[model samples]
Target: MITIVPVETKKQRAAFIDFPHDLYANDPNYVPELFLGQEDLLNPNKHPFYKHSSAQPFLAYKDGELVGRVAAIYNTNHNAFNKVNEGQFGFFDCINDQEVADKLLQTAEEWVKAKGANNIVGPINLTTNDTCGLLVEGFERPPMAMMPYNFPYYLDLISHAGFAKKVDLRAYLVNKAGANQRSVLLLDKLEARLERSGIKLRQINLKDFKSEAEKIKKVYNKAWDKNLGFVPMTDEEFYYVAKDLKMIVDPKYCIVAEKDNEVIGFALGIPNINEILINIKRGRLLPTGIFKLLFGKKNIRSIRVLMLGVLDNYRKLGIEACLYGRIIKNAMPSGILEAECSWMLDHNYLMNHAIEQINADLYKRYRLYEKAI
Candidate 1:
């Protein structure tokens, strides 16, 4: 028999966060998320996401043993912005058992249905602005920072549960040895042309991070407004994320396009911290884990070009190529050998083509699933 329990207390929440660690113990590719980070994300009071939305986590137990977990989310901001009645499920993990998976999903579906959602979509992990999608291809390696990963069987589990793919997200890998260097070579010329139009590209100023982040936030919202499932992040939400990234952000990898003192485009690349976090047992950052994080950063050899965007009006101005070129050029001296440019919507032809032009290989794919409630 199977039983599902809502995570209402501190103990249950802890168990819910820790379940994935145990389930993936034997999988060498599994990287545990930081315990405190996950704790804060699930905390209503701590995460800015909860200020405009609500979620309930459920843990599944089979014969008194923990087996799975999922979060039923009602994102008011998403619905209001997109004008759709959709609830989401996220933070999902489960054993390979079909029954357990079905029960866990059913619980989430019902909970969202009660909240008046006409359709359900996810593995969204709180929102589209956060880590999302189920790994449908490329399970050979661990995931990059801020990207999602799952067992290959998850595709079948979700399909059997009456979910179908809403869209596929792409992850491209660019190796220094294999990548074309034309972008780097032409970077100077590209910037000169952009400068003629009063747009200058430069690294983000750490000293002016607060004001810089505010400017970038506007560009981010505007640049990505037309994306599927996009909802503009509130100030609190943007700052909360910016604060966390600040610690790991390298100036060279955080490039901005400025015109008339306004930021119109930017690209952010973060060291693949998962390389270090994978070694931190259970994602605990204490006792010895903190040392691993601090010292291991220097040894990181790859970065994830996780975000790169330009305002719609600035498209096709070579700003995107310049951003990618600048990052690659700066990375060469830093001993960075490869980078992952990830989670691009498969249908985003212009962006996908831009990445491919630089010889990035489409190495991984993730899918979002949807079903009527």
Candidate 2:
């Protein structure tokens, strides 16, 4: 018999977090999330998302053995901002057993229905602002920073459970040789051209990170307003995220553009710690896991260009390419050989064009799913 239980206590939550560690124990590409980070994310008091959203993690058991897990979420901010009554299911992990997957989906669907939601969407761990989506392509290698990874059977399980594609998201790869010298050669000229329009690119100011992040938050919320399922992050939510990212955010890889001292665009690349986390043993930090995260961070050879957005008014001003050029230029000597620019909307032509100009390949694809509740 299979049982689906709401993770209500600390022990249940720990089991929920550790289920994947055992499920993917033999998969070389599996990367472990930091146990401390996972704990904080699930803790309402620790994660700001709980202030405006609600979530419950569920674990599936078969004959008393753990088989799968998922989280059912209702984000008030997402609904109010998008003007849609969509419930989301995220942090999903399951075995090939269709029965277990079915129970998990039903549990999530029932929870959303009780909340008055008419439709269900996701595999979104929390929100689109966080790591969401199922890896429908590129599974041989590990994922870049903040990207989700899962088995190919997951697509079948999700779709088989009646969830259909809402949208497809793309991730592009750029590396040492992929940076293309041709673009580097014209960066100075591109900067000069952008300068004529009062736009200039520079690295983020570490000394003013707090204030600078506030400005970037404004730009981020506005720039991505039209994106599918996007919700404006509250100040507390952004601060909660910023605090965690500040640990791995290198100044060189985190750059911003400006015009007349106002933020216009920015690019953020985080060190690819998935390489280190793959070895973190169930993503635990105690018993020497913390040492690996601290020591292995510097040796990471790749990065994930997680964010690069230009305000609506700043489009076509070549500011996007300038930001890319600066990041690519800085990666040359830093031993960071490769990077990924991800989760771009399928129809985002202008950004796709800029990514192509830098020779980034669409190496991975993730999908968001939806179903009528």
Candidate 3:
């Protein structure tokens, strides 16, 4: 017999976070998420998202053995911003058994419906601004920081459970050794043209992180306003994210374009820490994971350009290309060879073009799903 139980007690919550570790025990590509980080994310008082929305996590079991998990979320801010009665399902993981997937997803759908949601969309992990989607393509390697990964069988399980693709997100991989030299040569010229317009790009100042984040937040809110399912992040939420990133943020990889002291564009790349996390053993840092995370950080060889955006008025001024070029050049000294720029909406032509200019290949695709409640 199978049963679905709401994650209520601390022990149950810990199981919710640890289930993937056991589920993917034999999968080499699977990287366990930090227990501490996952705890904060699931904690209503810890994550700022709780200020405006709520989530309920559930675990599936067959004769007392864990089989699946899911989070039913009612993002009030998402509905308010998009003007739609949509709830989201996230943190989803399940076995190959269709019954397990069905029960877990059904639990989530019913929870969202009880909250007055008319439609359900997921696997948002929480929200579109955060990590969402299932890896429908590119299963060759482990995922980057803040990215999602799962077995390919997950695709069939989700679809068979009645979810349909809402949109496809793309990720591009650029190798420093194989970058198109032609585009690299054009970067200097691109900089000169932008310089003539009084636009200059520079690395983010770690010394003045608070002020810098404030400026970038403004540009970020405006730059990605029209993106599919994008909702302006609350100041609290942005700060929450910024504070966490400040730890791994490299000055060289975190950059901004300024004109008259206003940030018009920005790019952020984080060390591919999944390499170290993979060895952290179920994302626990207590017994030894902490040392692995701290000491193994320098050994990281790849970076993920998780965010790059320019204000609408700043488009076509070569700012985007300059940002990409700067990140590539800066990465050379760090022994970084390949980087992934990801989660671009399939319809975002200009941003996609900018990535291609750097010789980044469209290597991975992730999809979000939706269904009427």
Candidate 4:
């Protein structure tokens, strides 16, 4: 017999976070999420998302053994911004059994329905800004930082639950050996043309990071507004994420475009920390894991261009190509083997074209699903 329970206690939440570690112990492609990070993400008081919306996590047990888990989310901000009453399910993990997947997902659906949601969409871990989607393709290696990994059977399991494709997100892989360097070759000329127009590209100043972050946060909220499911992040939420990412930021990959010293465009690439986290036992950071994470930076050979955006008034100035070029050029000399410019909306032609110009291979694809309640 199987039963579903809400995660209300600290121990249950710990189990909710740890279940994937045990389930994926033998899977080489699985990387453990940092324990503290996941804890804070689920905590209302710690994460600013709770300031605007709410979420509830559930665990499925069969004969008293943990079998699966999922979170039912009611994103008030998303609903208000998108003008749709849809709930989300995220942080989903389950065994191979159809029964387990069905029960876990069903629990999420019912929970959301009770919250007055008329539709449901997910495997978004929290929001589209976080780890969203089920890995429908590209399972050859471990996931890059902040991307997700899952069994291929997840495709069928989710479909079996009456969910259908909402949209597919793409990840492009660019290797140093395979990338077209024309962008780098032309960067000087591009800069000169932009310089004539008062736009300049430069590395982010770590010394003034707080101020820089404040400027970029505004650009971030406005830049992606037209994209599907985008909701402007609250000031506190942006600050919360910026604070966490500050520790792992590499100046070389965090580039900005300025018009007379005012930031109007920016690009952020993070070292693929999953390479290190993959080796950290169960994502714990005490006793030994912290040492591995601290010392593993030099060994990482890949990066993820997780975000690249230009203000509406600044889009056509070739700044986007220059940002991608600068990051690619910087990565080549750093012994970086590969980079992924990822999670682009399938229909985002302008951004996709920019990535394609640099010869990035279309490697991985992920999907978000939705169903009417």
Candidate 5:
């Protein structure tokens, strides 16, 4: 008999987090997530999301053998920000069995219903700000930094369980050989023109990262305010995230737009550390995994332009192109051969256009699914 078990004890929760290691043991494209990072996210006492919402991790068992896992989330912040009574399922992993998938989804559905959610949505590991979405395309290569990956059968499994597409997110690839450098070539002239209007584009000041991060947080909260399911992160949340990213953030790949010393726009490209994480056995950074992460930095050959945004008033000013251009230009000489400008809203025309104009290929697609309960 198949049964769904609530993850309660520390051992059970560790099993829940480590289940993917076993499920994808043979999949070459599967990159293990850092165990400590995953643990921190699932730990409410450590993650700030728990300050307002709650979640539960579950495991599926078939005759005593673990078969699948999922997390049912009651994101009070998401509901309040979106004005919807919906719940989310995340950190989902399972075998090819439709029955197991059904049981897992049902478990989440029931858990969320108890919390008053009328509809369900996700694959969002935590929030939209974090790694979320089901990979529906571009399976030829391993995922870029912070992106999710899954088997093709996952689509069928979720669909068979009644989930339908809510929206599609896109990933674009830019290679040094095929990238359009017109933006980079004209960056000087563009900055000159913007300077006439009191705007300047420059690299982030790592020496004053704390203050710079605070300014960028304001620009970030405002720039993406109209995006789907976006919420203004609290001060603690932003600082917490900033502290983590600071460790790997490269000033060359981090840029900002300033108007009379006020940050109005910013873009950050983090090195694709998956190159090293893939070799970290089961994502555990111990015994030797920590050495790989620390010593393998320079061997990384790609970057993920994970974030790029400009204030509403700064739109259409060619600032976006310049930001993209600068990152591309900076990467060419740094031994980084490629970068992915990703997780774009499919309908975000202006931003999508900026990417396309620079000749970024839409290489991958990830989907979010929803079903009314």
Candidate 6:
């Protein structure tokens, strides 16, 4: 018999967090999320997301053995912003059993239904602002930092369970050795042209990070406001994330486009720390694991250009090329072998074309699924 259990106690929560570690043990490309980080994300008191939204995690068991897990999420901010009644399912994992997958999704669906959601959409862990989407393509390599991964069977499982593709997200790969240097070569001229219009490019200032982040936050929200399912981050939420990224951020790859000292655009590229975390057993940062993370920084050879945005009015100003070019130029000297510009909406042609201009290959694809109740 299959039993669906709400993760109420600490032990149940731990099991919910650790289930994927066991499920993916035999998969070489599986990368375990950090235990503490996962814990905080699910914790209402620790994560700012819970301040305005609520999510309940459920675990599925077959004959008393854990087989699947999912989280039912109702984001008040999302509904209020998008003007829709939609719930999300995220942090999903399961074995190859169809029955287990069905039960896990059903539990999430029912929970959100009780919260008055008429439509369900996801694999959206918390929100679009966080790690969201299911890997539908590119199963050959392990995922980069803050990206999601899943087994091939998940596609069939979700489809059989009545979910259909809502949208596809794209990830592009640019290797230093093969990347076209047109962006780098034309970077100076582009910036010079932008300068004539009072816009200039520069790296982020680590010393004034607090003020800088606040300014960039405005640009981030404005630049991405029109994106599908996009919700502006609250002050606490932005700082909560910014504080964490601060530890791994390199000033060289974090550049901004400014006009009279006002940040109109910015790009942030973080080290692919998954290189080190993949080796840390069960994502535990303890004993030997912490040492691996502390000492592994110098060995990392790649980055994820996770955020690159320009204000709507600033579009078509060659700001995008300048930002990307600056990152590529800076990365060359740092021995960064490759970079992944990721999670772009499949339909974003303008931005996609900009990345393609630098010879980035579309290597991976992820999807979001939705079903109307």
The whole-model lDDT of each prediction reads 0.94, 0.91, 0.92, 0.93, 0.93, 0.94
Instruction: Pull out the clashing pairs in model 1.
Output: none
Write candidate 3's Cα lDDT for 1-373 as tens digits.
8999999988999999999999999999999999999999999979999999999999999998999999999999889988988889999999899999999999999999999999999899988878998999999989988899999999999899899999999999999788876666777888888889999989999999999999999999999889878899999999999999999999989989999989999999999999899888999999888999999988999999999999988898789889989888888889898899987999999999989977889999999999888
Worst ten in a row by lDDT for model 3: 179-188
TM-score for each candidate, following the candidate numbering: 0.99, 0.98, 0.98, 0.98, 0.99, 0.99
lDDT of 4 by residue, 1-373 (tens): 9999999999999999999998898999999999999999998878999988999999999999998999999999999999999999999898888998998898899989999999999998888889999999999988899999999988999999999999999999999888998888998999899999999999998889899999999899989999888899998888888888899999999999999778899999999999899888989999899899899999989999999999999887899999999999899999899999988999999999999999999899999999999
lDDT of 5 by residue, 41-158 (tens): 9998899999999999999999999999999999998888888999999999999999999999999999999999999999988888889999999999999889999999999999
Backbone clash numbers for all candidates listed: 0, 0, 0, 0, 0, 0
lDDT of 1 by residue, 79-170 (tens): 99899998999998999998999999999999999999999999999999889999998999999999987888888888999999999999
Which candidate, 3 or 6, has the higher lDDT?
Answer: 6
lDDT of 6 at 43: 91
lDDT of 1 at 318: 89
Which residue ranges in model 2 land beyond 4 Å of their true spot? none
Please give the TM-score that candidate 5 achieves against the real structure.
Answer: 0.99
Winner on TM-score (1 vs 2): 1
Candidate 6's residue-wise lDDT over 45-84, tens digit each? Answer: 8999999999999999899899999999999998999899
* Model 2 C-alpha lDDT versus the unseen true structure: 0.91
